[model samples]
Target chain A: MKIICNGTEYEVGQGTTLLHFLAQLQLDPDTVVVECDTEIIRREAYEGTLLAPGQNLELIRFVGGG
Target chain B: MRIMVHEQEREVAAGTPLSEIAASFPGSDLFIVNGCQVSGAYQPREGDGCWCLRKGEMIQEHELRRLLSLRHTPGVQEVISRAVVGIMGLGGLGSAVAGALARIGTGRLILADYDIVDPTNLNRQHFFVDQIGMKKTEALAANLRRMNPYVDLTLHDCRLTAANIPLLFAGADVLVECFDDPVLKAASFRLALTDMKTMGYVGASGMAGFGDNNLITTVAHRPSVFIVGDGESEAKPGQGLMAPRVGIAAHHQANQVLRILLARAGMLMGL
Candidate 1:
């Protein structure tokens, strides 16, 4: 399946959960906010949401500074 | 009964007294029910529009209240005075933003932070030398009250999160995201965009280095999300956050907050 994460297109195994894909990218679930197809996916529901072909995902990672 | 709190609607007991209502809003001293100042013993009536006056703003005579804001034009000041703004973090950006809004006569302020004042924060964050050991909320509220006693300043002594974001920020017309961590900042803005259900939200990003004054801009990520920062200057080991540059970004957030409030009130100039 082809899913775009933060404007970068990536190929992942079919039926991959949003949580699983994020883990493969070395991203922490708590450190970023997830948005799928313009809808914000809550932290707890990331594992339940399955990515489809051509789906758009946005992972916003926040940094630490004033 | 339904009554307007700060600017949002709230429900309470069948005959909730002004005192009880005032207590829910931390640091509020005078309650305004239907545009009239009421005592603590007064009970709210149906469809009453209630709000609080900051400490030391209790004037028995309406004429005196008018005299206090005599310098500001009556037309726009009314809208500004009725506004309630929330500051999520009481650090450099949060403190400056709150102070600016208070000086502009924003009616109520909601401030949250669990951190305490430190000598290092003196360079950028707004705090007095004598306030080093106190909680940020306590120190900031004290300083804000001194700046504008007429502005109700509510303080929360806990670290803010997107959890229950709506309830925590329900009373404000605008919520300013001012956390030190980028992750918290993003989460704060995301909640405002998706969870506010009501009220405007402003956030900062990439306001970390110096010398690109014009680059520190306010960008509208969506119609609902507004960012105030250079969008490129992240603080790294080599680069640093200085007082002047941080001040600029803080004021940018403050100015954008006012703009959002004015636009909502339909009093925006040249719009």
Candidate 2:
């Protein structure tokens, strides 16, 4: 299935969990805030959340510089 | 009738127009009532608060406010003057951001940073050569006070962790993420989006080195969350943080912050 993340579409396994999907992208679940379909998924919910085709995800990572 | 004019109680007629009060002060061109600008024809009731702006005067707090008010229309200046912004770091971005906000008359600033000014920071940070040994919080606070003494400043001289981030910036209407550590940045970003959802957020990323200035930009990742910078450059061996590029990103964060605060108060003017 294809899921939209940060305005880009990515193909993932059929039943990929949000946590597993983050790992595939090489993103630490603790570092990025995931907004799935307009609702913010809690840190703990990343494992239970499932990705469906065409689902919109906004991933905001905190990269540092001042 | 009793009314407070410039914090002093004075007597006026029961239905005296604000214009009459303004006329009492020579060279005055602006008038504020109850924290909002009012037309000269508007009459003041008993105990109404009032302020009259006179030209060529430098009366500390009131004068600073008057000067800022001149640049913005009525309530726009008032909204900015009443805002409280929290800055999380005191480096290149946070220092410049605070300086801009102070000059613009942001009512209160909550500044947090555990670091001290280093000789190496003179390149982009706002500290002077003599301030190298001083704490960044103290040095920045002193500089901000010099820029605008009327602005209220709250300084935290300790390092901020996810556990204390929310409490440190509790009353801030907007939070600007300016940390230099990726770990702290991520922690604060997650909390701002989740726990402190009510406050607006502006964070920076990838502004380092002497690359193309035009490449630096601001992006709205969420409704109230903004990220500024190229999102690519990093400060490494050959590349380092400089004033021009870092300042560009800093002002972007500052400008985005003003946009959020002004929009919240329904006074976002222009584009």
Candidate 3:
């Protein structure tokens, strides 16, 4: 299955969880907030939430600002 | 050729290189060359005509005004030509803070504001009557640039919403929170803390009313969150800050910022 992460397409195995995909991409889970199809996925559900093909994911990183 | 040193007149060979002029000053630790402070490893070029060098007791340029005046050492002017600081507001406190920072030679400034200058802003804002209808960010940027021509000013004439806050602050080393609204202040604080968690960025708050002067204290350990002014002090609707009081707080904020930068560079220690 394929999914888009940060504007790049990634092919992944079936039944892949968001956390698994993020781990496969070598991204730091703590510093990023994951959004699936414009909806924020809770941190606790990252391990359980499954990703299907063609899913859109946005990873926003927090930066210092005022 | 004529050169102004310590506001006095002096003559050097017309074609003297700046590096040769700098090398002529023996035992001097720093040099203010051509309106920019520099030290160590800067060689003057061929076109570098005679330039002013302001230092102590070198009266070959001009007669000493007074013994006390001769005793006074002009603070070393160190210009950070690459620094980029982001200010969140253009109101009373932000105006004073931005002006002070610009005057002190913060080379780059990014100002963000979504409002328009108003008549009431004349009381404490750094805006003229003609700027009343102008966007606050653009007006403040113009005012700051007019004060210092070397400043590279960018005006983000838009509201700082959560969606764009990270992008706006990505390149800044320090963030100054000058917004007055409680909701906006809280949001900014949260954003700053989150940023600190991810990246090592310094930030500070406070500088609104007059009575809060006593609350201006710099936190020792976490310089990232230097909360100045009384956190508990609240501003009443329709009541704004005065110039003198806000000016003092802004000075403190700028000092803290300088200290933080110096510490990061290993030049300063122990607050």
- The DockQ of each candidate is 0.29, 0.47, 0.03
Worst 10 residues of 2 chain B by lDDT: B65-74
The TM-score of candidate 1 is: 0.73
lDDT (10s digit) by residue, model 1, range B170-264: 87888888888876877676676677746677888777767678988877766546878876577788777778888898998888887887777
Poorly placed runs, candidate 3 (over 4 Å): A1-66, B1-79, B196-208, B237-239
Global Cα lDDT for candidate 1: 0.78
The order by descending DockQ is 2, 1, 3
lDDT of 3 by residue, B1-271 (tens): 5665444555667555455665556655545544455554455443332233446535331222221122222222332444567777878767777887786667577788899999977877788999989999888888887766556787788888656877886787667766666555545555655444332233334444566466755543245556455444444544346666556656666777666655655566774
TM-score versus the correct structure, for each prediction: 0.73, 0.77, 0.57
Q: List ranges where model 1 is wrong by over 4 Å.
A: A23-27, B1-72, B269-271
Q: Candidate 3 at B36: error in angstroms?
A: 14
The TM-score-based order of candidates, best leading, equals: 2, 1, 3
Q: After superposition, how far is residue B221 of candidate 2 from its true place, in Å?
A: 2.9
Candidate maximizing lDDT? 2
Better of 1 and 2 by DockQ: 2
- Summarize candidate 3's per-residue lDDT along A1-66 as a digit string, tens digits: 898987999998999998888788776454346768866665658899999999999764322111
Could you tell me the lDDT of residue B146 within candidate 2? 88
- Chain A of model 1, TM-score against the native? 0.90
The digit string of per-residue lDDT tens for model 2 on B138-180 reads: 9999999988988899999999998899999999999999888
